[model samples]
Target: MATEKLDVEKSSVELSSSVSDINLYTLHEERAGRLVVDPEEAKIEFGEAIASKLKLSHDGTKVLWPQPTDSPNDPQNWSEGRKTLHLLIITLAAIVPDFDSGIGIASLFQLAAQYNTTTEEINNLTSNWSIFLLGPGGMIAVMLMRRYGRLPVLFWSQIFALGFLIGCTFAPDLNTFAAMRCLTAVFGTAPQVSGLYIVTDLYPFHRQARMVNLWTMGFIVSPFLSPFLFGFLVARENWRWSYGIGSMYGAVVCLLIAFFMEETKYDRGVKDVPEPQSGLRYRIETLVGITGFRMAKYRASWKEAVMSQLNIVWRPHILGILIFEGVLFGFGIGMNVTNAVFLGSPPPLGFDWTPYAIAGGYGTPIVATVMGELIGRYLNDWIMNKSIKRNNGVFEAENRLWACYLAVVLDVAGLVLLGASIQKHLSPAGLIFGWGIAQSGVMICTVAVYAYCNNCFPRYAGEVSALINMARTMGGFAVAYYQVPWAEKNGALQTFGCEAAIVAGLFFLIVPLLQVKGRSLRAKFSL
Candidate 1:
């Protein structure tokens, strides 16, 4: 009996020691394989329900992932052309609503005069109503998308956004305009957050970073270009025309989504067993029809989905990413908006800088942002894969933070130059150079932060994304809200100097915290 007790104690110690081998509830597969397998499917398909033992393929060369069965209906097995089309549709969807967020800034003076309000009040259209909506709208969109799937939420949101956008174009008074704008915020912001979820669903970690860079490009570019386009357009025509054009763009995108954006939510039933062909007519019907109505195999309760979104905040790693993103994005938006104010004022050059002139100044940062995204795409992919290889096939979430570290240097240097140029009344080219560099750094930070969150919590993509959106939106609001007052009190040099320090301090503190402790934290609290 004493020997039997000794043997039992030894077995228990061995079981505890082998805990890492049993990856039961990870966001990504932890096994040493090139392909990514769906954990839930591995349980259902394999005997004894062990995820680690049930890799979908043993073939070393073929990169089979998310354990797609041979079914053509599974998005994991979708054709490259089909996936590209969906990506384009999602990218366009993001651009149109995001354009609404910044285009209003170009027409600020006109809106102030037309509404019989101060410039501060009109600024809310850009800073308050537009910026704040992105987070909450994303929250609602993610919950609904998680429950009903992505297509319905996207389709209906676009429909509502189109209606409200047109309503804003025709609104007679400030009250009506603000009301319509708020409504547009609620519905128009789906694509910004949902696209990340789709990327996680369709791509593996090795490929997700580049796809995220691609997904982020349209969103960042649209806001920068909106100011330029609407500044020119409003100068020639009515300010309302910009909103009208946006509504038309939304209408076209909605039509494309209705026809081509297939449901991407992976279902477990299609695990290993190829689905039977449903004939050409059925295939065509699904191809060009509303597919979101079809039920997913593992539908969670509504309460569960909502609870999951709320629970995202409790995750330490996710919350850390949110804070970092919020600060970076918030400061970027503040700088972009404040640049217009500074340029439009009595500058070292002259006070004659018209709306067109201010808008043209935006061209520098816009170009820089686009270039940064393109370059960052390649760098992000290379860094993440290289790190994975070096770590012996174990991909650490911290691998993405290397980009952020480099971005911090660029952002701080650019801020110092921008502040000094403003104080010395330097040439427009000087301001342009600083703004371009700062904006590029911000772009890199955005992509890196987003990729980190997505890689860390791919299963909770919707919740993670919505939270990040909310954090950044809140950050944008806080910065934009206080910017004019702060700059007014301390001057641009002091204000931007403070910004540079704050960003550097936050990056230094948070990046190290996440790098050293993030994995253990994630392990303790599995998503």
Candidate 2:
């Protein structure tokens, strides 16, 4: 989809501008290529050396010589089963680190009690996980999406995450456990890119918001079941079982991927191209990923593709979304996690698992999230369609962003209530009920904002998504360190309430028609 749109904008001059990976730039007509070229021509004169090479679909879908004329290059044109496989692969790759975040916190007290260590030491594990999942991990993943196939990268990451989980299970010391968590964050976070990336790959540009929301649901699902499992295990078998369960779950997901998932990284409906050129070291690694330069018809060196990938990393829109989601979602969500700890602990604020963990997280918020996702997956499509029609069908990307209004409303309201609820330290039911609103509101934000960011780029969805994760992960990291201390110092109520109001206020200001001038107030998120 990206290549097709780009080719449309590519004047003859841009092709020369892209001349670096010249080898991959040219493709030979072969099996896929030949059949592609001759829709009506029964066995054209190539009689002897039935030339071999993949070709881009004609009508400019970014392939090489001898390709189909009408190929759409949109992943949606693939089989229904293929789409499902793509989503599954992403869920497998993306869900682990996220599940570990909120779920793992409950196990901290148990872990420290067993080792006779302090909670502060255990907190490092969260830091390591956060940094890898959203920071350096995201930056690294951006390269992989362009260099390696999306499916391969996603598949490998899940398998690696399984390995890390296993390592965590067998850890002899806190350091060892911490190390495994970090490693998993690096490898396992690959699929998170897929969540936003696939919307562009598989759906029509106008149809993207709902799909992005659906992927967020996949992410939300893992956490729904994760905390319960964590609390149950840590309370019964000790904290190690928490790691064991995650590892086992990851292993099962990896197997599912190996068996059912298909490689979606290929440019659907198009022949591959010679990638834009780049440096020597980058090319060498690209060769390995491009399969020893085996996919020669496309003429892309591992090096050129990497450069193309890097180009995406630096885009302002991608950076904006990553920063926005990573920080805002991370800030709000991370605060929710830490505050839950503070609010639930014994004291005038005496709280327990039944209300906090089970009722709030597992009950009200879970149900609300499910409802929100259903809206995202199904009803949201209808909303987008209506917006498009009202716009006279020009279909700017901003048309799809209105769903953010709901999220903004909930986020502000929840933050305000949460801030006040803390000082009140109400009964468990009262506290959790208010907290549930915050959790659900954040999920709403995650679903809508994520869709908005990913859809911002019809092309380079993977890169855009990667940037978003980086920002979100970094935000979570900052929150992991600062939110609680800030809340504690600032009259927990005063500071949190004020921050919540600010976020809500900002969301309202940005929630209008999606752009100011040509600049796009939401940046490139203009429908």
Candidate 3:
């Protein structure tokens, strides 16, 4: 009887050891540097002893990234409904800045006339300035976010943004209005930068691409949607009405954020932190910025915060993505800013489209954006999943670059079509179709690059967000300065054709370089 009992114990011990041998969770830290994981190896049989040792996805097929603790306060552990609500609120907030910036697009002529300035001057002083400020604003916001916490910085910044926007609605001169516009952009950038942080906070790696696509839809769609809706409004009412209505929208966003958005600044690194409070205390602390103050000791110092943003730019993959994404995104911005001028200018110089027609035409990009979102929502994940499976469940960040090939083709074709159609004064349908195609490419490019950068440097998520925002805004800033003059001087065909060639050449050169050598570059310059 004793011998039989011992034999049973030995069998049980061997089974447990075998199950443990298949456990990939122990290798997470070692493989994290390369973002390489074997999800198949991570799978554990139901009721295995090792199963209790790690957190798995809902289906129990893979281990979760940035593993959540047992505490319900972890954003990763939040209920689905709560997470969805938070995402919705963040999405809405993210739309406000660019939406406000774009509201002026349809009213540029009226704005210039009212302020006794040329449209070029108005574009330079207000629109271009505001766009340029977005990059610096994101940098400052992220610095504060690192030290002060996400919710506080976002809440307070939006409050100030609302104030500045109201000033924009009432400014009496071009100088005042331009100043207000710049200030609004500076304050409004919080949501744009914070959107990435919150998404990273709430979702694991496998789930981030889809959430990012959803969040990015809001960001990408807002600039176009504002012009479409407000184009009609400006036609019917005074141009100031657009800003007035924008202020009202800002008020609604503020209310949603104050009431619903929770503090997502939980430190997964700190093991000894106290459990978070519930109900009113949590609400007040987060809303008033006290939560950030309380936790500041564990956060990065001011010097470290500033340096972190600068240091991220030094990484090879990050630098490559910044330049690549920036240039493509710049062309998209150049097109958007130039579209109204191209279609609305008088006589032989332009299409002479009515405000209502321009508004309707904006729908082309809107539909294209939605289509891109729908495709990217699945496509990004599909690409990542396939790459993982093909590599025995190890995901390489460079794999994300494959999607950019499609973006390159769409962008080049769209730019060529847009340039030719405009230069030849082709039908409005041709121009709109080209615009839609280019806009779709922008959507795809933004998502793919964002996912790739984040995957490359998950620990530096905040800095990554800031740097990406900076690259995008600054690139647009430079292009907006030259797009109109270049188009007018060189003809739209030559200008856009050149732009398309740049996009193609840049992508073909940079993307392949990253794919073939990105891992080595990252390993060589690990930031």
**lDDT score of residue 85 within candidate 3:** 96
Per-residue lDDT tens digits for candidate 2, residues 418-516, read 666666665656555565665566666676666555444444566556666666666666666665666656655775676676666555455452443
Model 1 scores worst on lDDT over the 10 consecutive residues at 27-36
**Collision pairs in model 3:** none
What lDDT tens digits, residue by residue, belong to model 3 across residues 1-527?
Answer: 99999999999999788766643322333343354334445433334465456676888755687677677988999999999998999999989988989987978888988988888888888888888898899889999999888898989989999999999999999889999999999999888888888998899888998999988888888888888999999888899999999999999999988998888877766646766788898788878798788888887888998899778797777897798898898888777777888888864557889989888888888898899898888889899889888877567888888889888888889999998888889988889889999989999989998888888777677788888888888888888788778878878889889989988888887899999998898777765
RMSD each, Å: 5.6, 10.4, 4.2
Q: Candidates ranked by lDDT, best first?
A: 3, 1, 2
Q: Please give the lDDT score for candidate 3.
A: 0.84
* Angstrom error at residue 116, model 3: 1.3
* Of candidates 3 and 2, the better by TM-score: 3
TM-score of 2: 0.75
What would the per-residue lDDT of candidate 1 be over residues 341-400, giving only the tens digit for each residue?
677667442234788898898788789888889879888988866775676545677778
lDDT of 1 at 314: 74
TM-score of model 3 vs. true structure: 0.93
